[model samples]
Target: MKTKISHADVLDITAPSGGTTSGLAVLIGSLFGIAVTTNVAGDTVAVHTSGVFDHVKEGAGSGQAWAVGDAVYWDNTAKRLTKTTTSNTKVGYATAAALTTDTVGRFRIVPFA
Candidate 1:
């Protein structure tokens, strides 16, 4: 364990263009996580890489319904979560079922999911 670094549940990284907000999803390169603090672009912000969160999800006409344990992906372009895997980063699994009309759902953040 001597070579171990700090616990990685939270990471400090430079914010991307347009900045990042507290309690929102952030996708840097291939790494995806939830912002733990708000910061302007280029500034360092703490991002939580794990745990359950309630976040915005693609809803209704544009997306499909979700069931608990369903794989979830982060749609950075739309700044929301979706069940669609194409061109999206898998962040975690759905912690709660979400109807097609639901805009937000419970998500469990799994590192490198």
Candidate 2:
């Protein structure tokens, strides 16, 4: 079975290079480990290796080479951690905000579910 923990409200995010924190992913009752990024448009993060982004961070470093199927949890933001497996298109409501700068493979949370 799978689940998602969403916050009561959305948090305002701002950054120099659109670096504001976006949606977060975390297991129920567990601590968050990664940040589900969102851009200023207020949407779920789209994973792509287009190489047209500005900044991307994953695991322990920043880069532009994330795997296509990588998953990221939320972190360091001011809101509650929310982890979900509903994927992007299937989710009814929009996610926080995601900039295409983050690498798909690099922006991962944990290995197991």
| Model 2, backbone clash pairs (residues 3+ apart or across chains), number | 14
Model 2 has an lDDT value of: 0.30
What does candidate 1's lDDT look like per residue over 1-113, in tens digits? 89988898998999999899999989988888889888999999999988899999999787589999999999988999998899998899999999999999999998773
Residue 69 in candidate 2, Cα distance off native in Å: 1.7
| Stretch of 10 with least lDDT, candidate 1 | 104-113
Evaluate all candidate structures by whole-model CA lDDT and list the values in order.
0.91, 0.30
Superposition TM-score, candidate 1 onto the true structure: 0.93
Candidate 2 matches the true fold with a TM-score of 0.19
Please write out the lDDT profile of model 2 over residues 1-113, one tens digit for every residue: 25754441322222223332433332222322223464443344332211222223332333323334434333323232222333321111112233334332223233232
What TM-score does each of the candidates earn?
0.93, 0.19
Candidate with top lDDT is 1
After superposition, candidate 2 runs with Cα above 4 Å error:
1-28, 31-61, 78-113
All-Cα superposition RMSD per candidate: 1.3, 13.3
